[model samples]
Target chain A: TQLLEQSPQFLSIQEGENLTVYCNSSSVFSSLQWYRQEPGEGPVLLVTVVTGGEVKKLKRLTFQFGDARKDSSLHITAAQPGDTGLYLCAGGRTNDYKLSFGAGTTVTVRA
Target chain B: GAGVSQSPRYKVAKRGQDVALRCDPISGHVSLFWYQQALGQGPEFLTYFQNEAQLDKSGLPSDRFFAERPEGSVSTLKIQRTQQEDSAVYLCASSLDLGQGVDEQFFGPGTRLTVL
Candidate 1:
């Protein structure tokens, strides 16, 4: 089974601070997706990076996929209290519908 | 149109008891998936359905776990003789199509199951 490992399982920062979360894996993937989940709710898709070295931005959040397709990253700028939640990265393999997800990073932005 | 929705936001069952979880996907969604998520962990794939056909179920932990989507709209996951280790949150997701490229999956609130 392919495993995606995320760095900094927990993060706490001030509202104005910036943070970056990393997701790494040895296995290659066809596409990678980023999601943020709040308490009592399922994960909500933030972005999907399909091509190697692809990058996408949503508001203050930026998502990037590695050139090897084995890793990905999510960067949040000027974090706010509303950004406090669990962030997850998932990857989909070629010709497969299943997705392998990283453990997750819990971010807490203090106001 | 409504997003994916799951029934019974939470369930508590005794060991060896039988439990059923239900999922209602978005209208006209052609692909549906079920995943199990332990506390403080990411969701793990459980099964996949394309319309009424169950395409893959390799992620099911054991034979006691069974999932079915009869009409391709609503799906049910039943666990027989449930064990304590089977406790986790069950999430249902749906995508418009799974043809190629990236198919964004929309998820439901999920049903949290606890076995005593």
Candidate 2:
């Protein structure tokens, strides 16, 4: 069984602040995906990093895959009230269709 | 185009009752997945289907949980004798092709099930 742990289970910040969330695991994965979910809605994919040391930026969000593929991070720049949501990191193994997700981090950006 | 869709946005059932959740994947999608999300938790994989074939169900927690994707498009997850622990939001996702590497999955709003 693979486990993904997320740091800073909850976060609150004022508008324009920057925040970083971390996801770590002992097991290596072939791909890692970041998703943001708003209240009462399903998670929406933000970005996916496949290679080691890979970084992908989506507007105000930046996602990084660890060099060992065992960890990942999501950073939000100039956060806004609309950026508030539950952020989840999911790791996908080679040849497997299933994804193992982290516990998730809830972020609240106050305007 | 419409994204993946789930029916009965909310469901409340008595303990020991049987409940079935439905999922309608995007047209022409080849891969479909089901996940369970408990309150305040990330979604956990429950099952996967490649067209009409169930390729993986190892994530299912118990024998009482059953899922089927008949005709390769619409899928159903049925739980028998629902328990309090079964209360959770069930999500459905569909991808355009096989493999989890490149094809991005589109998710549905999910069905919130509450076992009373």
The candidate maximizing lDDT is: 1
CA deviation > 4 Å runs, candidate 2: none
Model 2, A1-111: lDDT tens per residue? 438999999999999999999999999999999999988888899888999999998899899999999999999999999999999999887677778889899999999
- Give a tens-digit lDDT track for model 1, residues B2-116: 8899989999999999999999999999999999999999999999999999999999999999999999889999999999999999999999997232688899999999999
Clashing residue pairs, backbone N/CA/C < 3 A, model 1: none
Which regions of candidate 1 are displaced past 4 Å? B99-101
RMSD of 1: 1.3
Among these predictions, the greatest DockQ belongs to 2
DockQ of candidate 1 is 0.65
Let me know the TM-score candidate 1 reaches against the reference structure.
0.97
lDDT of 1 by residue, A11-108 (tens): 99999999999999998899999999998899999999989999998999999999999999999999999999999999987678888889899999
